[model samples]
Target chain A: MNLATKDIGQSLGRFVLTTLGVGMLLMVVMAMGGIYRGILEDATLLVNEIGTDLWIVQRDTRGPFAELSRVPPNLVHRALAVPGVKSSREFVFHTVQRERRGKPFRMAVLGLSWPSDKGDWIPLLAGRPLRQNHFEMIADASLKIGLGEKIQLGKETYTVVGVTHDMLASGGDGIGFFTTADAQAIQFDVPSEAVRLERSSRAARGTRFELAAKQPSLLEFANLPAAELPQIARPQVSAVMVSVLPGAEVQQVAKIISGWDDVSVFTRKGQRELLLEGTVEKVRRQIGLFRILLVVIAAVIMGLILYTMTLDKIHSIALLKLIGAPNSVILGMILQQALMLGALGYGIAFLAGRKLFPLFPKRVILADDDLLMLAGIVLAISVLASLMGIWKAMKVSPNEALA
Target chain B: MNTLPEANSTNSTNVSDEIACAIETKGVTKIYGSGNTEVVAMRDASMKVQRGEVVALLGPSGSGKSTFLTAVGLINPPTSGQVLIGGEMVLEGPVAHTNLRTFRRNHIGFVFQKSNLIPFLTAVENVQIAMELAGESRGAARRRALELMEYLGVADRASNLPSALSGGQQQRVAVARSLANRPSVILADEPTAALDGERGRQVMDLFAKVAHEQGAGVIVVTHDHRSLDVFDTIFEMEDGLMHRAKKP
Candidate 1:
């Protein structure tokens, strides 16, 4: 007795195909949400980890992820000397591209201020955290490095001590955790030939000085291996991670460090906010705008579709009216069709997403609240879209059925 | 002879009128537009139909046969007039004495030129929906729908979609639907226009059979002269006036 459903049943092929079209459109909308969530998750992954209370970076720079930042390694000692400062670790992070297994591989190397911090923070899937500082590493499972695997980095070979899952670098690249000294060595590593060339150039410059002429032995000092030289400045680190004592106000400690002109200090929360709002703000907005556009487009398409479906039933509607069908019955027909279309479309999007989302390089989190919100939105859009069709049906006069 | 114009509105039948009048209209006139675009579709059209009788409104296209049918069906109220169904007043001028939709559902039925069956529904559902909308229970409506289809001799095609049934079958199903609520008056406009002469006569005969057997006053608007013998009473229209015609 439900005329609309019975009508749809008569042309089920067309109905199914139309529902599938709506589903595909909704699937794109779902992808937009998933991609947006993925970007935010990837952006904040490292900020949530690390467990540091403050980040001390080069003056006027945002933390390392937002921009290039380098602070002297001694900044860690300065941070430790502050009252209520529990611990400080030198942070060194850089990306390394090396040929492995005859293919180019990119790895983000993060220096754990080891012996004090042995990467105990990483959620290991296998193996153990770093015990020795020099050449041991905790590799992200993304790096495809197995436990006990050894790979040459910089001037030394490192053994993979632990393998962790999903512990990616800020850029979403696989990360390898090493000691600060080992990381600095890898960052500043040079070939022996280049070292020879650089040493000779320095020696030649030293010989031109009047001090070198008065004491020619000074040139021999420059000729010694670069490591044994005394004139070179100490190696700098990307930043310093500082943690406060339990029950100590991190804001107060940060205010104390703010007095130092050489470095800018930020609480961990500030770092995350900067990365989200500054580093990935544009991408997030673009995805959000695209999501809005898609929802609007879906609504418009559904409106047109429902309107056309109403037009198809124009004669039948008039006939029903002539037979004394009330407005509620006619309205129910159109409204129910719209609701069915939207419900089926959303169902398709969820099923298709379960298979498709994983293929994306970035993680997609379909949160329960987000899914529920989208369902509500779909319901609203369905009702709004059906209004046009209902309006059209209402305009059909029963007299149209005569003659 | 109660012809039209002056004679049409002069007589009003009392409850004791013979044959038990099922539908009566007095001085029904329909006017559309004004001034330069002024047109009168039906003027002083009065009619009386009794139970167990089938009346045909015969006319050429644009002669207001359909206009009068629509007015009688309560779908398009006349610009001026009064209508009575089952010997009780139901409409005056453009105003209805009762809820027009509910009143029509219980007392009037309509069949159009091309069956006008809802395409999405099966033959039986098309019939059942009318009764269901009239407040019949689903099971009762369906059972009555099947019974009416059976009475109309299309019971075998009850489950088929409108498109699946033959043209003649679809029209029979339309008739079956009109009778689903057992309305006292049935109004049809060119109900056989889409059928061949033989099929047209058959459906016209079916209308007469429905009225005679069910004791409903039936009126059909048609220009087809081949089926004139099927109607118990006949009326012809020209311009915007109606006059009773002698049955063949």
Candidate 2:
């Protein structure tokens, strides 16, 4: 056996304890990387789940997540008119905090056209989809709202008709689906006192217009009844999602939609990029910075441990030198020990990560590529950490063995 | 007894025709530091050891016995001197003409006062590693290690770790390791200092037996003169100076 194995065998208890400590630190690092992966997944969940090939939003706006986007409710018709556009749906997205059993529950609400096959976009874990457009909602299972439970939003109460899994927004808020009409009313419905004030202001303005009118045609508008006055507020949608026919170029259809005034279009790939780079970029950076810090900490810990272990063997190293053992042999021993420690730590961390990630509130996705990358990084860190011991071993004088 | 190869004429010194020696030094001196800090550790120390000869280096503490041994072992080169090992000029002053590590591995061995065995390794593996480092095949190294342990009468404890062996047994394993490469010279610094009188004498006798049987030049630094009769020659050091003592 090599020096590393033999040394470990001799001091198995200390080796195991050290490996456990390093393993805990490694688990935290891997978890941070997994958190970043989760954020990316959450950011693109809706965009991917909607099964739409293109998105049409208000001009000069990124999307529902990046900026406030509002388009006319009728924009679905214009999107459907584009060549190769087989189907179009109005999509509404907004966050709402509602009181549930005395606590405030924040949820992301998505509105879609009713009675369309698009309702199937949400994979149900229990119950059924919303058959009737009004007073019905599908809640993500993470919200803990049971099917058939009633939740009050604005002036209306809706029943939770279905529950879906992993349906969360970029911010890790649970998602609830509603019909377009119900979502719009919940979003824009004014309080009774404000509506009364608006009506009174309009009546006062109409009375003054009647006194100042000079032309005959203008007099007709001035004397109009208050009930007949034009209403300025109308239902609006955040964006229109469009699906293209098979074999159709989505970019071509997006270009056609982009030609419209006061509107922008995005293909599927563009929407995903916007969600990832625009919506969760800050969270990604934070997690990335944490990952880097943890890696540095791990490296420092490994280096210090190795340096200490080498120091403990200083006399033995001197004896080896005196016995005509070359510097390479001593170096190999230290390096092998470092690598073994790293491998042990990694193995423990991997097992712990698999069991612990699910317990985190946010989804933690540990991909095979990520695991492979981390393994390579750990090996590199082990080599780099061993350099300190190697340097110290090289400086050991064989004469010290004589004294 | 195994016969060692004869030294070539090219490797011999002009004054050593009669002595087929394994080691020779010419006026070796080792000076540490310089200026106000300068101190002479060894002064004009010279010695010759023939193949199959075991010599005792007896001196009081701080008498530069270790300095002389280290210098001859190629661990610390002398400040001003020439050292020839196995008939080849290996060191001139503090400069090494050959790769000292490789040269030491092939032609020199060392046993320290504490046994200084690798704590993690068993007796046989510890001995085998020396041959392995010299580029011997693993199987050959293991076979030779087993043979050495058998010859040293420690074959029963070959698989026991150094910690499991007694003080004398550990030293025996160390001797086996020192002989693993069939070195021309073995330099031991108080190989039995830690043992009791009986165990220490046994270790000293093992050294003499090793030197005679393996045909190697052995120089042992020690303070225990009770075992002086085990040596073929004896030298005493005082204030960095060495001279031959009357044979006992």
Candidate 3:
């Protein structure tokens, strides 16, 4: 301890410079770690906040968070009838591109089943949830849209009613909620000309529209009626959310529902993991690779710093050895210096990561526990780096001091 | 720097003969390698210096003076021989009596041609560290270091680093550091070789006084003949052998 203190005091400038260099490396590591945490948090936001144990969705579809899972609305009734079902609500999801001030913003829009907070996942910070079924919207804080402001989606303009915080999808896109009917309208709304063209095409195909126009002529032809045209089913939904009775198991209910073979059922947790694996998995893998590269770079920098410091003091080490200083003292000195560098650098990096992270568009969540763990990692790497220099220092002979 | 007291013969001044034989070696041989490529750095070298005695080890280049010094210093073990310091059997045929580092710190002190002081430390701190290594309290080490510096006339330069000192002054500071732990024996390898003729002679005279007043053994390895008058005894090495020069 005494030797270490004196050595550090004597070379303050060099020590600070070396530690600063290490600090910069630490900063990058902290930022990457924070980004990883941020991704998980953002992806799990709605599911975690909603506090539901089971989710009912279409077979083989991860849905709303991962991919499209639109079950028929009637399934909600059957899910409620299942054993242990406390209650069930319908959740409608769509991806809407809204144009505000001539700029388009892609947002994940969830439609709340009214009159029940059980499935109304987000709690509004200001104002209230949808009282009216249609034309009302609750925007996420990150959506950058103010309450009372209107945004255009397809042919409809809906007024923003409330604001919610941290409610984001796995894609890190902003979230907004509205009534199921409005969401369906937004999903299926088309230009009037397109609607007219569809009707004209059906008429031109010699269907019901042609028979209506020649009704008087048909009457004149005595008792021969024009044939009726078949009706086309509107676009059907592919998934539903379900809540079960207080004592019943969702998996058991899901099994029964899935056995029907009309559709599949998924628990909320399963849906979440599936979403993460299917949609966010590629991004996570790429980020993981980049993080490993950053760690390698930090380790290399630590090794280089330790090596250079040892080289700078080669003569002193030789003289100390010649004077019969023990090998342990020399080794301890080098290792301690490396550890100190790591500690100081880790501290600097924690602050740097915290300060710079907020500016990034993606949420960067840095937890204290995570930072502490990263600090331990950095220290271990530094110790490993010091081994090279310490080994070299130990091998230095007192004979070199004779020179 | 204040001048050290001149060297004086201790026998005329009434010192006991029981204090004689501070350093002793018998048939010390150091070989560099084994088999067909072996080289003999020092062969069959033996010498002794009494307590409170100052001796000069004189030799030419490649004559094994350093090899003998290092062997006696317990750095490079001899291929064969015995060494005794302060009456303790320290070395016998590639073996040592105690841990080499502990033995060096407690019983032996070393001074080199360049002073070899740690440049980062002040002169006093540099001297104090030797005492610290010997397990002295920090306060005691500082106090003792100051006393040694005062004794060597370097007390005023205690705070100055080695770079700030003159060649002669640095040599004196090295002398103070050597005596910091009150070692039984002091070994100097060309300690004054880097200084001028006058400063070199002055350093040799100080070594002799330190021997007499401090009651410690002093051995100098040098090629300088100008300071010969200051040595009580002189041993010359030639071809890895030692021969005593007749005292004037």
User: lDDT values of the candidates?
Assistant: 0.86, 0.85, 0.78
Where model 2 places Cα greater than 4 Å from the true spot, the runs are: A82-84, A101-103, A146-159, A188-232, A245-256, B1-20, B150-153
Q: Is candidate 2 or candidate 3 better by DockQ?
A: 2
Candidate 3 chain A least-lDDT 10 residues: A221-230
Q: For candidate 2, lDDT tens digit of each residue in A231-303?
A: 5435689999899999998888988889888898988788899887887888899899989999999999999
Per-residue accuracy of model 3 over A44-94 as CA lDDT, tens digit each: 777777666567666666665677776767777877777777777677776
- Residue B125 miss distance in model 3 (angstroms): 2.2
lDDT of 2 at A303: 95
Best-fitting candidate, scored by TM-score = 1
Better of 2 and 3 by lDDT: 2
What is the C-alpha lDDT profile of model 3 across B1-248, one tens digit per residue? 44323222353243354556678989999888789989988888888888788889998988888888787778777889998988889999799888876787777778888888877778998889788767789898898888888878889999998889999889988888888767678899998889999889889988887777766788899988888888889998888888898755
Per DockQ, the best of the predicted structures is 1
**TM-score (all chains, Cα) for each model:** 0.93, 0.87, 0.88
Off by over 4 Å in 1: A97-104, A144-152, B1-18
TM for candidate 3 is 0.88
Model 3 spans with C-alpha error above 4 angstroms? A96-104, A115-128, A206-238, A289-293, B1-17, B246-248
Give residue A217's error in model 3 in angstroms.
Answer: 13
Give the CA lDDT, 0 to 100, for residue A164 in model 2. Answer: 93
Docking class of 2: medium
